[model samples]
Target: MVNSKIQAAEENLIHVYNRFPIALEYGDGMYLYDTEGKEYLDFAAGFAVCGLGYNNKELNEALKAQIDKICHISNLYYHVNCGEAAKELNRISGMDRVFFTNSGSEANEGALKAARRYAYTKKTGRFEFIAMEHSFHGRSFGAVSVTGHEAYREPFEPVLPGVRFAEFNNLDSVKALVNEKTCAIILEPLQGEGGIHPAKQEFMEGIRKICDENGILMICDEVQCGMGRTGSMFAWQDFGVKPDILTMAKAIGNGIPVGAFAMTQEVADFSLKPGDHGATYGGNPLSCAAVKKVIEIFEREDIVGHVKKTAPYLEKRLEEVAGEFEFVTGRRGKGFMQGLVFSRPVSEINLKTIEEGLLVIQAQGNVIRFLPPLIAEEKHIDEMIEKLRRALRKLQ
Candidate 1:
């Protein structure tokens, strides 16, 4: 049964999302409490956005302090935290310039624009892009255009022109799509919505070589797999192949609704100028404060190191869970981003897990994607697996 809060929300808001019945009230540590005060062990971590977890005292204090100082000041003037945030992002990402956006979709949009603008500036007459198959970028017009999912692009019939789909982790497929008009290749190093498939090291190096040979820009969409989610500062760092353009969001601000697209010095010099792209609330003081604090916390606490230490345990526990379930076919992913493949539709199983006091989410290919908080420990993994086991038993 839906609670009063959920009912009220449904009545007022557009029915775009088929939301769950439970109305989340608040969170403490890795657990979320509903309106009726039922506790749930969160494995989704708000779709991997809450890296620091819920109600973190230090993060909260940083946000509260920002509120006390000032919140929204337009980008016309400089704010205290924006430059600091950008510097930290560049320092961590190894990108030369950063442009902040409100969400991953916008970051991707800016990235697409940057890639095209780079070609335009160079007078290369190359505007086409090659994106990976089964990849999910975002829902915006340009992001959806190169998304590579026909269902997503079908309704939006006329997407950005000159874009082609390529088989992910297949260098030949990407090479086949490249031409004189091909300006960029965009892919997620570790695909999140496409079933947690990590790109092979050789495949990554091959793409870099192809881009270098063809003079095509490489863009890595790290919106889901970045910011310590993959036990690296960015997923691409795992492969040691740097991209000309990189997009990041999700855990960047630890839940502050901010995203960014960064580029190397070469790309920055040739791409999107002041008149080409602008976001009004993109780098607002409030969001920058969150970004600044999140990065500072990540550095001070060595969150990436923690993920590296804890990920093996997570993988081991998930393997056990997969072995226990007859329907579960396999387990795959990197660090905190893991998935369990099932033979049957996982929608019912997801609902059942929630009933068993756990929260998880699904990806394509009947995948039960596990994007637990970076703060998750071995104990949390044990509890998550046990709760999931209970849910699976109920289904049986």
Candidate 2:
């Protein structure tokens, strides 16, 4: 049955990804079951999208209730949930206004636009952006233009101009690029796709300070690192720095499709007018309901505290596995988002771990990223490390 499904995907669907050889049927808690009922310990969590884990009862109920009432009512009309979702996000993120989008890409796009438009009123001819190397924003033209990786951008040459690259975690490099034409400096607080590297406190503070001194908007791509992954509503909170604009997605709606870019009242005022930007199904009723429920669940359960508690155990377990496996080069990241860097390519270990019923994310080709649900317990960490041990033993 799984084989047939894979064949059908190959025959009918576009060949964009070289997916793992299992058809996930359903997921519950920290585990996913395949079509054949083989259980896989889920550390990937759909690349940090499934923060509450799979089959969340409250979230399911919320979506179901909203489905019965109304699933979508585009931006032309009001959905109480839509406004409520934005209110909740603003209340937590400290941003003055919110613009709902469809994905992290769209949110980043909005952030970029907000930066440029705000700069338009503040400074003359400030259209350039300085982004960090090794950063992965998204695949959209604007998002990809700011993304620093060569491979992701090389495909779509002649990307949105006025974008320059700087080394991540280096303040001097960013300052070197800042000139009269610079509008914003964008970076991930903890880079998810670029090997799970977290910025140091000084670096983050420097970025914030630079943005302030230069009148440049500091835009954080919190799509992967936000939603309590780093033991806060937003990862920038850990650094004691607030962004001029922040973009969040992935876990914000649990598993639903919703994203948002928020900014200060000043930026929001100058950014986009009625004719400038819009999304048709951006903040529909159903997705906003999911967002509300997810935020409520996080607050009620103290999900950030849960991640903070379990993260040390997860890190310790990964360290032990590294001590046992010589190929394990290092570990990095904060809270629930971490990566085990390998001496060689991670492709073998990734597949081997999947074969042994553990699902982890492969990042930057040589790192195995663990982005477990925020609800993951110590037992889940133990299971993940034990399965990783099995996979590493195969290599030895």
Candidate 3:
């Protein structure tokens, strides 16, 4: 039976998303409550955005205080939280300058624009970008242009031109795509929607070297794998390689709609100046306040350290669970961003898991992607496994 709220939402909303049947009312810690007050262990973390989990006192208080003070002062002038948030992001991400956006897609859009602007400024005539096959960037025109999935790009034909796709983790394929007109090579250090594929260390190093040799910008879309989800500030940090431009979102604001694309000092010096790019609500005080508080909580609580400690346990349990399920072929991913590869489509299993009061999501390649909150502990992992086992048993 459909609830009134869900029915109303469906009526009012565009038919873009195939939303889950659960209509959540609130959440606490690692659990979410539906309108009927059924408790559900949240493993999806709202598609890897809500890192701090639900009803965080510190995060809530920060937003309340900011609401009393100011929300939107526009980008025409400076604000307190914006600069502080950018500084903290820079301190953690190793990038020099940042331009805030409202979502991950916008961050990628800004990054692509910055890359083009840098080439334009350099008079290099480099206008092309090399992106990875099976990589997910975003849905916007600029972002979708470089996105490798045919389904994402086919509907929006003639997206930004001069983009080529290379097989992920294949240095030779990436090299074959590079040319004089290649301005940037963009990839996710750990792909989220593309089946939890992590870039090989050699592949990362080789891309960095190629970019260095060819004067092409290396853009890392850390939208899903960044913000300590990989037990590092950015997934690229894990590879010991740095991108010329870094695009991030998802967990940065801990559920608030905020994202940022940062650049090296050299790229900043040459790209997106005074009138080049801007956003009306991008760096507004409200979103920056959220970003500021989230980072503060991460540092004070050592969220990354917690993830480093807990990830191995999660991985071990997933391995055990996969071993128990005949259809589950294997597992992959880093830190809390793990996935179990199944021999068949995960849609029915995901629905069954939700019915079993465990919230998990799906990815490409018939995989069940698990992006639990960064604050998830061993007990949470155990509970998730138990519930998941029930779902798998019923399905089998």
**TM-score per candidate, in order?**
0.99, 0.98, 0.99
Question: Which 10 successive residues of model 3 have the least lDDT summed?
Answer: 73-82
- Collision count for each candidate, in order: 0, 0, 0
| Model 1: lDDT of residue 241 | 99
Candidate 1 structure quality by residue, lDDT tens digits, 20-123: 78999999989999989999999998888999899989989989999899888877889868899999999999899999999999999999999999999999
Model 1 lDDT vs. the true structure?
0.93
Task: Give a tens-digit lDDT track for model 3, residues 1-396.
Answer: 789999999999999997888799999999999999999999999999999999999899999999999999868889988999999999999999999999999999999999999999999999999999989999989999988899999988978889999999999999999999999999999999999998999999999999999999999999999999999978999889999999999899988999999999999999998988888899899999999889899999999999999999999999998899899999999999999999978999988999899999999899999999999999999999999999999988
lDDT of 2: 0.91
Error of 2 at 302 (Å): 0.6
Clashes of 1: 0
Worst 10 residues of 2 by lDDT: 116-125
Off by over 4 Å in 2: none
Q: Pick the candidate with the highest lDDT.
A: 3
**Per-residue error at 110 for model 2, in Å?**
0.7
RMSD of each: 0.8, 1.1, 0.7
**lDDT (tens digit, per residue) of candidate 2 on 154-190:** 9999999999999998889999999988999999999
**Candidate 3 displacement at residue 265 in angstroms:** 0.6
Sorted by TM-score (best first), the order is: 3, 1, 2
